[model samples]
Target: MPHFCRIVKSGIAAPLLAATLLLLPPAAQADHADWHHGLSLIDKLKYAPDFPHYDYVNPEAPKGGDVKLSTTGTFDTFNPVLDKGQPAVGLALVFDTLLKSADDEISTGYGLLAEGVSYPADISSATFRLRQEAKWADGKPVTPEDVVFSLDRSKELDPLYANYYKHVTSAEKTGERDVTFHFDQKNNRELPNILGQLQILPKHWWEGQGPDGKPRDITKTTLEPVMGSGPYKIAAFSAGASVRYELRDDYWGKSLNVNVGQNNFGSISYTFFGDRDVEFEAFRSGNSDYWLENIAARWATGYDFPAVKDGRVKRESLPNPLRATGVMQALVPNMRRAPFNDERVRQALNFTLDFEEMNRTVFYNAYTRVDSYFWNTDLASSGLPQDAELAILEEVKDKVPPEVFTAPYKNPVGGTPQAGRDNLRRAIALLKEAGFELKGNRMVEAKTGKPFSFEILLSSDTLERVALPYAQNLKKIGIDARVRTVDASQYTNRTRAFDYDMTWIVWAQTLSPGNEQLDYWGSRSATEQGSRNYAGIADPGVDALINKVIFAKDRDTLVAATKALDRVLLAHNYVVPLYYKRDMNIAYWDKFSRPAELPTYAIGFPTIWWSKNASPK
Candidate 1:
């Protein structure tokens, strides 16, 4: 859910996470020893408890080689708990969660740090039995105190953590290796699985003095490499220039069921570049081993290199048809501001956007217009809301827009000059009805004579191609639209404070979306600083619909409620929907070998892919 300013996402292929803030093991079924090892919400656990390794992994895969990846900006802090500095990629490599989620399964996970877990029938509280083998880099045992400290510290430091784990009321060390998390509410199905994903921090090291002899504050950002208990540790670094990790031979979980053929790299490294183009060039030059291509034009035309032509570089479009990604990549309008706060003004902005023209011109026609908040999923509403979806909407019919019942939500089409003019007239008419007037070829507020204008804030100039044309369209309708590009930090800060008139925001959603819906669109989070509610949505109907989604009894109920919510959100023009890619476009040097099968939802890159340079035994 946009990471609430902490994790600025760049990869479109990054999944709508199973858990909102972190990846987690699947949900547990009941309170028992058998249920301790694995969990599932709606379906049977895919892999048995005694399974040796994930089916998508090479159970006997070789484990040695170094691979370099590319990053655009510098990373200042190694501390991932704070919202301050950009946390480096592969931070997860250094830490471990209680349970690990299998890639192919949508709602199942197995024990990792925790050997077993127990929860109440109602799922009010969950107890995790820590593996005695788990140890920090310095050989200190991972304890229940560490788990308690991790939860309290993370919630205190990161807003995303605070929001994600808000339902977790308290954590306590119940036994020698048992840490139990108590929930504030009952029958909230996703809590056990979410709590299992709590990234356990080493309490002793964090509370102690650092190399500077200063007591470390988890709330503040730091460059000091964190002490962790995972498969790899920070071996070398030059701040943002580059960072390398050495896989630990002494790693505690090396022989576990989940770790059988994973973390096979002897070393993994990342090099910083000026931009994505430079990064791609680095990959083409064999400096980095892998690349995820997002630029449509580059993918369609730029891969004429000799390596690609001769098959030295492998390119694959990995498509998972069953994956349901609820992604909204759009221009988010801050409703707290004027003109945007008015429905007519917001609707007018949508009419000004000629997606078909923009798709052909800027995006190389490689994208599908995002039609729903839950697009590319069964949850996306179409035509008229019928049956269950209709029933759900009827409860809030008065609270939502009247057109929701009378009209289907469809973005205006404009590729031809005639269609463009038609859409332009529609936009002007909406503005006129909203007390705006086109005087001397410029729209001004009828009450105060202020020009209909606002800035389109962007983090990178890559978006200018899209925003500039949109700005031109707005100007054509006698509205003054300005475009501004700033650094990622400034863009994040401004958006966090709700200071921007409009900006690019993406809210990635999972197939099983729950609790986090509150942080996404709840009225309470609208004013809350560091919320995923970037557009400041606070409609009563939205609030009611979100609650319905959160409390959905079964899968059918969840889908219907989500579709109803989508309809209401579309009815209001909070975001000018943009384009989205359905599949992952990836290219890599032919120096590595992955399992014959890959994870269902993700590409299983460096994590599950092993280097082919290792000697066969």
Candidate 2:
């Protein structure tokens, strides 16, 4: 899967909800003596401490050969913690996390750098004992100090990490090889598993003087690859154009059970192209080894090349079996801006989108309309709120839109010309209600006569096709909506600063939605720079419902709370919901061999695959 700053669950499997939380027996709860080799937020772990290898990997797979992949956009930094620059793809390969997630499970993680983890019954603090054999690339033993420094430094340097680790009070070295993370509150079962996702950094390498004899700053971007303790190390690179990672033959954990069948390539190289079109051309010309097709139009008609015909290149549309299709990709209207702040205006904008036409024409009828913020998931509210969901919403009825309880939320349907005209009339009436009147071809303020105009900021030209049609619809209402395409870095900076009237944004959801919901829709994050609340949502109803979601006591309450949040957010029209596909379209060369059954949650490419004819380098 491609790396987005925001964490998202990809695939169509039902997410692990509150109901999936394991309930321990009385005897098990009574004894605090037994420590665990892994942690899970939902289901009980499937692997034992002495388990040899994961079910989805070939333990005896040979490791050699090179796999060349292509990526769009340029990366100027090798640092993964910073939010500003585009970090190199696959940088995670060079760093080790304290615990590694099993791809087949929704919420289980086995110890990677840590040998064991222990927590009290109340789950306030978690203690991890570092593996004695763990060592950095520079041959320094991985220590408790490194773990503590990583947590504190990450929280200080990145807002995402700060929000993710907000409840975590401090990480202290309890023993020579043991580190304990203290939390401000207890009973957040997800916290321990989330902490396992921490990508540990070598404190000594980062704090030491660089080649230029200057102290290295963790907050700044650096092209000189820093020392890491993972299976691969940066061998060579051409700044933004390309980067190659050479496998560490003497890696300490290569033979570990969690790593036996993974990182099979001796070296992995990523070549960057300016855009998807050029990248596709490079792949077709045999310059790149793999490509994950995202464009429906291209997927339907662009695979007639000679390589594919000759069977050298393969195309596959695989089913995502690990997660529910939970994504809200939309034209996010910045509520902080004028006109958009008005609920009537935001609602009117949604009336103008013709998703049915877009899917049929541009998408080759490959996508389904995204009706809910939590689309294709149990968390999505369907029909009108009822039962437990209704009970939750009743408390906030006075504060939310009345229609949230009275009518089911639905996007305006438009397929034919007549349907489009009817929807446009409805939109015009809503705009008129919001104090705007169509004057000839321009919608202007009724009193001051100021033209209603805003630019739809875009990062890729591929989106121009989708935005241009939407702009045409907005133009019908006399709204001067123009599409402006910029580079990825510019788009990242502008969106991070919340400096646009309207822009394309995606909020990816996970199986167990927890504290991250605060960063996504919390009032505090609305004003925070580099926050993910792109719509600038700060509703009291949303904030209250998010709390309900964060501190939900059981599966039933969590489900009800999540549905309530979904209903309120949909009612607000913060974004014009777009479309999503249930399947992942991917293409790769035929030189690699993979397990018969892939992991449930991920593509498991590169990680659980080996070259057909290769040996250890």
Candidate 3:
């Protein structure tokens, strides 16, 4: 349940559920008419009402030792949901979600903080009944008031969450532990599941005073430890360097069938570094227990250290077959700017970069060139729109690019010097068509003589490798592209505000696409500050298609609508297509043991893997 689109670093009203909370009882063997223990999006629940622990977990996995990890940025606060400061990692371990997503299946969730959840045939609303045992760290039972407070406050605080919960109009207490959410629209499947993904907050704690003897404000950032029903709490920390969470000895839900073999760590710690090289070095030198490597060059050659060769450190590539698909990993140009406003100008920039040559020279030839906004999935548009997808696109033929109907969209190709030259020539022609002319090796507006130059803002110095090469390529095409690398804080602030001309961004997608599409490309979000509409997409066709996806009647319609939307987004060229590797690159210390079959969609690292030693000492 990637509940929302993560910037590859990493759903709104996405009727993402299509059946997000569809509870089909084995005994009943029919449609959803009553509440059940498990929740799913399929015709039948993956785990039956009387099912034991999940199949992917070790029912008796020992849990004692700690796991150490690394993060490459500084954090100023523990309030992750707030828009204010950089929230520390490991905060997720501190809070319990209303439901748990199934690893083997897609768009399914099981009650975690709540014992069970109920929804109607129309899916206009969902009611969650908290477990009697669910309690905050301070020993307060999690009530309907807490659940209501969580939903109302989250939408009020962040625009991202606002877009996610836009259709959800109100929440109220029905029964003793029951909290009900009413929706503004009907049949929005994703609303239930994303709401199921809600991390229940403690209203009693936040309404009270902090350690400093002042009333706690949920809207503000804070370093004071939070009270939660989850298995971990802040044990120790430095302001911006490190944070450690100790497993709660009295965690309320340890015995819950859904939590079996999970939360195995006695303690979990995250050490922060300012650089990836330093972070990798720390993981290599045994400062940390595991390393989920994302850089291809490092995975190819950086493991020359002795530990990797020896049995001490293990390097393995895990494939996530059930992992959610469709990622636009690209240098996204801000559409609010003058140069990027023209479709031809954007296409010209896409032709300038040589991804194949870059892959051969820098990426170790490990990745595949991404073509579709939703690549590696059935939902991605292919050779041509046909049948249902074609019909969906024809509705707003005028609002979208004509090529979306007449021709298939593909990135301009380049590998050799000749191919690169040919692409640049095409780029030149496109620029000319867009009323820009090459003069003295500088691209400028042909009529007014306004120079076209923009900076590619980047957060990590490590990404400088990719940006620098692309910028050099652009320079060859008479476009002055400068690369500027800043610290994490500045990068976060700038990107959130959409301040750069272009920046490396990753827009991740799940199998079930819904309301979050509006947040990504909606017309209203384009002008709204802090919205994720990074490319400034404001097309009525996109909005209509997005609504189609959100309100898609069935799974087939959702897929077709998603494909139509993907086809339109690509035809417009919002981001310069980048590359992606399917297998997860991971290196870890050989000190832990895990289930023989891991979750199909996730690695289930420290959370599910227990130390072999099984000793806190």
lDDT of 3 by residue, 1-617 (tens): 25642232321111122225454522221124356666665446678766778888987888788789988888888875677678787787889888887777777888888777777777777777888999999999999999999888888877777877888999999889888889999878777778878878899998999888999998998988777889999999999999999999899988788888888988899999998899988998899999877788989988988987878999888777324656667888999998799989999999998999989999999989888777776788988899999988888887888989889988888899899999999999999999989999888889999888999988788888889999999988778899998877788788778898998877777777787788889999898766788889898989999999988887889889999999999988888988887777889999999889887776778767898888532
lDDT for each candidate structure: 0.81, 0.81, 0.81
Q: What is the TM-score of each candidate against the true structure?
A: 0.95, 0.94, 0.95
TM-score between model 1 and native: 0.95
Error of 1 at 352 (Å): 0.8
The positional error of residue 517 in candidate 2, measured at the CA in angstroms, is: 0.6
Candidate 1 per-residue C-alpha lDDT over 167-247 given as tens digits, one digit per residue, 9 for 90 to 100: 899999988998889988876777877776778899999999999999987878888889899999999998868889989
Residue 25 local lDDT, model 3: 29
Segments of candidate 3 deviating more than 4 angstroms: 4-33, 615-617
